[model samples]
Target chain A: MKLNDEEIALRAGELGPLRQWAIAHQIKVGDYLGARDFVAVGQAHIMADTESLGAAGVDWLERWAALPAEHRLVRIPTITDPRGTDFAHAAQLKQQPWMLDLERRAIAAFEALGVLMTDTCINYQTIMPPVRGEHMAYGDTGVVIYSNSVCGARSNFEGGPSALSAGLTGRTPRYGYHLDERRLATFLVELSWTPRELSDWGALGGVVGRLAGDYSQVPALLGLDRVPSADQLKHFGAALASFGSVALFHMVGVTPEAMRLEDVVPAGTSLKTHDVGEVDIRALQARYAKDVDAVDVVVFSAPQLSLVEIRTLAAMLDGRRATIPLFAVTSPQVKPDCDRMGLTARIEAAGGTVLSGMCFYQSYAREIAEANGWSRLATNSAKLTNILGGYGYRPVLLPMEQCVAAACAGGKLT
Target chain B: MSGEIYYAAAGMGRKVRAKALVASDGFSARYDLDRIRGVFSRPEHKLAGESYQGRVLVLDAAKGGVATAWMLHEMASRGVMPAALVLNRANPIMVQGAALADFTMISGFDVDITHAIPNGAEVEIDPTAQRPFIRVI
Candidate 1:
């Protein structure tokens, strides 16, 4: 398939590793976009729903209508991809009243298609992304980052598109990142501080993401001595996607695609560079400050809580209770283990609830929160902070330790 | 734990802490109400949800952290100590939603509490009033 001008331009912005991989793979170029200069590689969820223009989008819809009618739409909910928990697992809903609603939404979507329904949020590691240098639609910033930087696949920071447009027509807009040459580094982010903590590194991603633009050339991050842990990397990619319109970044030696600072963008060649410090992170959760209040529950999962997070919370709240309640959300993968170890019982005795699979951010609509008079929510994800306010609920953004501590106190961690 | 530290009429320094304090929940005078309220008061003398079922005390974490703690001292004057602890995170309206599911058992309910931690900081309710007040130092 012949790629469009926009697709060509986006591919041009890819980093060297991805760029080279695309060129060597001889992938067909998908055409039909408007942008002529730069196309940032983007991903698709179902791989066929996105369209280059509304016209194409409409045309594809018409064609889908004209089909023989043998095709079926698949729905994947609860878990974006299937890494944990089958698509039909009702145990989550049985255990948590909230899971009932979640399973309903996903089950309706996958009424027939039978989506993999992997529960893990990290699709790149848990599920396979489009082959190296292949263009695909995907959600989750970290997955997008991994696709563009590590797998040589290209995608955008898709929230709705990555999830919805995946099965519309089995075709993308035919623009941005679908071609070679659009993946080169355009902007340079020189990091002058050492990121000691995962949050700090995540902050760096946020700062850079905000600075980066639609046609962002791969960013060459400098000034850090240590590599972030996988979990920390997840935070970094997530934070970057939340603040900036970025899909990926290049941390010189840190990135799988980037090897050196010079490899990002040619020196002094109409390329622009921005510098950031630790301040960007402080501003991320400006809404939820230390102004402590009566915190009843501390939620640990949004994009699926991790085992480390679960263990840490269990330990911190090993023995504590406030005049409030404590709640923790973890993936089902670790739930049975937590139960077997009596972590669940210990926490329950101390007054805390551990939920698996379902999350409050999306699963708990107004009805549920209003039903229980839970007008307030506490969390650390900036995306949740942005969305919770729109739902007529109060969300408390705090650090993990403080969140659990607040829960242990059965009150706010002020 | 929910209750009132009932002070004797026209009395000073004399407090009788009830095991359960029942009141409407919209008390956000302080940004961090839990610690402010929890640090000083014991769990038994906290707040109760939906007509007290046991000898539970009700303490609002919203009132002045220190003021309420000191004021609760008068609760002892009422001879209502040795109470069970019931901490409900819900506003006054959600007796069932914010019930002490972590500690107390409901008659026919097994509620799973889901914690939504946004970037680690407690995602506060009504952040519009906060106006960039969080600090790192």
Candidate 2:
């Protein structure tokens, strides 16, 4: 990788050991991914949940945090993804004390390095949305996919370590989505039917994601009757990134990049085209709920709920009483608004719990499942269903109304 | 076939020799692993219920979330991790994770590496070579 004078200075330890280490790490990644040079990123979002960043990762952060403030502070605006636990609801989630302690240590270490504890995956919706053509280093696959596909910002799947390195150095390796040529559609997806509900949109994403297969392939959708809302795209992009390791996608007409199919797909280019209809989406959702007639818990998360999503959920729960645990997880930014609008009280009045700044699967899911003896999980999130299978949960993907109905019917599918 | 060698387009970390666990399935530390047991725990995974510790994981692609970036480091700290990873394709998360943990990983090949290498075969992965490769030995 070609380094400029500033990079050379950082490499030579003229800045500090922390910056030196950050640059070295970035160089290693750049060399591996065939990056020719470095690109300046406007912002960096780090995903450092204690569950992912075990003892060693936290210790690693603390070592840097112990450095002088001048040497350790992030060069660019850096924020965080949803943490492992919401401290206020830790006891309620049955997360062990050690887990909480680790979380606190990780938080302190990040704070020392000047990282904002935004604790959100919906940062594109809550925090500043990136403008088209802007480059960023973002963690959380959902954030990367949404920001790239929906917002037209450029980013790869910058993980926890890479995002922190970008924050420290204010730049990332210029490769992958940063290159314009890499953004073209490798696979073409034609939609035979459009989805109405968020869950259906997510199911559509899952179906399309299975076809996209990997990070390198970008799928361009050709048909959509109307423009879907941001929240709909949120679920779709999150599920797509989760099910597939895809970073960027073009929606032909909906997204910023591909205003027309020709914009992403050159004229006369032959691509592997897949046609997805209502049955394909329904089939994907049906596979998750196959033998499960009932569930122990119903959660709405994985991208965390937007304000509008929260309001819709609150409205659905207004007149119903839940017999099973139903969790509505939202971002910290949306939580305040939910409170101000009495959405929180309405959700709680229906015997549901509203968790803030924490996602279901990210929050020590396996441990919580064991603690609560919850094996059959129900959620409206296709992404959650795709994830919880490894955590020993039989997750059923349903619409928000059906999930609310299940919560009211003692976890029964009816 | 025992002495056959396959080269990778990109690689990092030291060379390692271990038994190969071949699968045509994708890998994600958070989505497909039970780190405590050091086994492929996802029921849908082809290597489900199989121990992955100290083996060369020759798999299809890197799939799913960013958690794998920190997970490789965490798994290495506990001494529960693959000896090396040889994949047909890799995502940034996998490359970043391998970089942080200093874990041996080589990806991008002329053919599907999973089919090239047999399961449980003794293999040597040399990432430091001018042209990184995995050899059946």
Candidate 3:
């Protein structure tokens, strides 16, 4: 990797140990990934939820946070992904005191490093949306896929550590999705059906993602009768990233880069095309719902709800009182607006909890499930379904309306 | 099989020898592991119910979320982690986590490392070699 003078100085320790460590870490990752040089990124989003970070990671961050502010502060705009727990609802969620203490410490550590606690996976909708052709270091898989595929920005799956390194240096190793050659579609998918509900869209994403198989392969969709709304694409992209570890995808005639099939696919390229239909989407959902007639809880999260999604959920829950616990998780940015618009009250009136600044899976999911005796879970998010299995939850994938009905009808699947 | 060796395209951390736990399944710390139990917890995973502690995990590809980047380091800090990770392909999260944890990892072999390595076989991994490799010892 070629280093500019500033990079050299940082490595040489003239820029203090924090940046020195950060640049060295970047260079190590860059050389391994075959990055020739660093690319200046416009922003960095870090996913440092306490669940992922653990005690060691938080201690590591605090070590840096104790350093001089000049040495530790980020060089560019750096934001956070969802935290481990929303403090206001921690007790209700049955989160232990230790978990809350860890979250507090992690938040303080991030704040000390001059990181903004955006606490959102829907930053593309709630915070600054990246423009086409822009470069960024985004941590959350949902954020990266939405920004890269929907917004036409460039990024790889920058995890928490790499994203923080980019934040410190204002640059990232130029490789993977940052290169134009890597942006071209590797596989093609012909959609025989267009989805309406967010869950179906997410189910479609899961199907396509399984076909894509890995981070390096990009899947371009061919038949979308209509352009998907931002919220629709949000669920699709989140599930795709979660299920496949895929970074970017293209939807022909819809997404910015793939305005046409030829735009994303190189000429004369005979791609292996897979046809996905309504049957495939239904199969994916059925696989999750198999043998689960009832659920202990219903959740709406993973990408974290946009204000539009919240409004839609609120409307669905009107005059409906939930017998089972239902959660509507949204970003902090949208929560205040949700409150002011009475959406929060409306959802709460229906016996659903409105959680902000935290996502379900990221918030020590296993412990919370054990604490609350929540074994079977129902959610509209495919991303959440894909994740909760290992955490000991039998997650049922359903549309939002059905999820609401289940919540109101004592967790019965009907 | 006593002295067979497989070269990798990329590697990091130091060399170590351990028993191989091989599977042709994708890996994700957050999705497939129970860190508290030191075993593969996800029922669908190929290595489900197997103890991964201190064993070299030979797997197909990296999968799922970016939490593995931090989970790797956290796992190492707890003294419960794989001896090394040998994969056919690696996503950025694995590389980033290995870098942060200073854990042994080597990926990108000409052949599928998972198939080349036999389960529970004694093996040696050298990530610092001119061409990093894992050998059946």
Candidate 4:
């Protein structure tokens, strides 16, 4: 990869050992991806929850943190994804002490390096939304997909190490979604029905994701009658990134890059087109619903709730009393607003816990499930449903209203 | 099957020989693995409940989450990792994970690599070759 004087200096250890390591890591990734050169990025978002990091990763960070402060500080504005535990609710979630210890260490390390502990997956909604064509090194799959597809920002699926490297280096390899030729539609998806609810939208995205199948295939979607809300797009993009490993999608007339199909689709290029309908979305939800009526818990998370989504939840739980635990996680930025507006109180009054700064799955989900005897889970998040199945839970994907209903009725779907 | 060989577009880490845990399903450390038990724990996955330790994983693509990029190195640190990863296609997350862990990985094949290699077949993956490949032995 071609490097400027600054990059050469960093690679040569003229900058500190930490930056030398960072540049080396970037070079390896750039070489593998065929990046011709490095491109300066505006910001970086890291997904380094304690569950993913484990003790080894935390210790590794601590090693870097031990370096002189000047050598380790990030050059650009760097933020974090949802942490593994919300300190306020760690005991309630039944996370082990060791997990908390590791989280604290990781947090301390990040702070030493000048990273903001935003602890959010929905940073696009809560933090600054990237402008069209803005370059970023974002770590969360949901963040990458949303920033790339809806916000028209350019980012690849930068993992924890890679994003941190970019944060330290202030640049990333120009490859994948950063390049124009790679952003063109590889597949065409025609929708017969636009979704009515968030879950339906997520199911639709899941169907598209499954069809796209790989990160390299970009899908161009059509047939939407109206514009969907930000929360709607959040669920759709998160599920698509989760189920398909896709980084970007173009909604023919919706997203910024695709004012029309022709804007993203090159002339004379033939694409494999598939049609998706209401039945397909229903089938995708039904696959998880199979013969399960009772759940141990109800959750509203994955991409943390927006203020509008919180308002909707508060309205649904106004007169209800939940017999099972219902967790409603939102960004730290939204949590204070929810509290000030009494949304949090209403949710808590209905036997629900409005968590902040942490996603449920990123927490020690399996361990908490074992502690709470929560195996049958109900949620409105298709991305969470797709993930929790591996963590030994039977996750049923339902709409927000239905999930609230289950929580109020002793976790019974009926 | 012993002499059959398949090539990959890119590769990393040292050559490895292990039994192939072949599946057409996608892989993600955060979504599909129980690293503590070294098994594919996701119920919907083709290799659910199967142990993946020290085996060569033949899968369709990398799916779900950015956590795998760190989890792979964590798993390798504990010495409970797959011998190598052979995929039909790989995402940036997988490549970054393999790079950090210094683990054997090869991806981008002409044919469906999962279908070409049978499950339980002893395979030798040479990622250091000028042309990286996996051969059924």
C-alpha TM-scores of all predictions = 0.56, 0.99, 0.99, 0.99
Q: What is the lDDT for A225 in model 3?
A: 93
- Which predicted model would earn the best DockQ? 2
- Cα lDDT of model 4 by residue, A1-414, tens digit: 999999999999998999999999898888877899999999999999988988889989999999998899999999999998889988988888989998999999999999999999998988899999999999999999999999999999999999999999999999999999999999999999999799998888899999999999999999998998888999999999988999999998799999999998889989999999999999999999998979999999999999999999999999889999999999999999999999999999999999999999999999999999999999999999999999999999999999999999999997
Against the true structure, what is every candidate's RMSD?
21.1, 0.7, 0.8, 0.9
lDDT of 1 by residue, A1-414 (tens): 445553354346432222222322222112112223223333333211111111222232333333332443322221242221222333432234434444444334433333444444555654454566666656444566656766567664333222332332233443445555556676777666666554455556656755653323356677776876666666666656544445557777877657776665656666566766666567655534445475544555544545666666667766676345455655556677788888878777766677665444444333455555665666655444433443455666666666666665655556
Candidate 2 lDDT at A187 equals 93
Q: Which has the higher TM-score value, candidate number 1 or candidate number 2?
A: 2
Residue range with the least summed lDDT across 10 consecutive positions in model 2 chain A? A84-93
**TM-score of model 3 (CA atoms):** 0.99
- Candidate 3 lDDT over residue span B43-76, tens digit each: 8899989999999999999999999999999999
DockQ of each: 0.01, 0.92, 0.86, 0.89
Q: After superposition, how far is residue B5 of candidate 1 from its true place, in Å?
A: 70
Docking class of 4: high
Chain B, per-candidate TM-score? 0.23, 0.99, 0.98, 0.98
lDDT of 3 by residue, A69-136 (tens): 88999989999999999899999999999999999999999999999999999999988999999999
Q: What is the lDDT of residue A156 in candidate 1?
A: 47
lDDT for position A79 in model 2 = 99
Write down the RMSD of candidate 3 (Cα, Å): 0.8
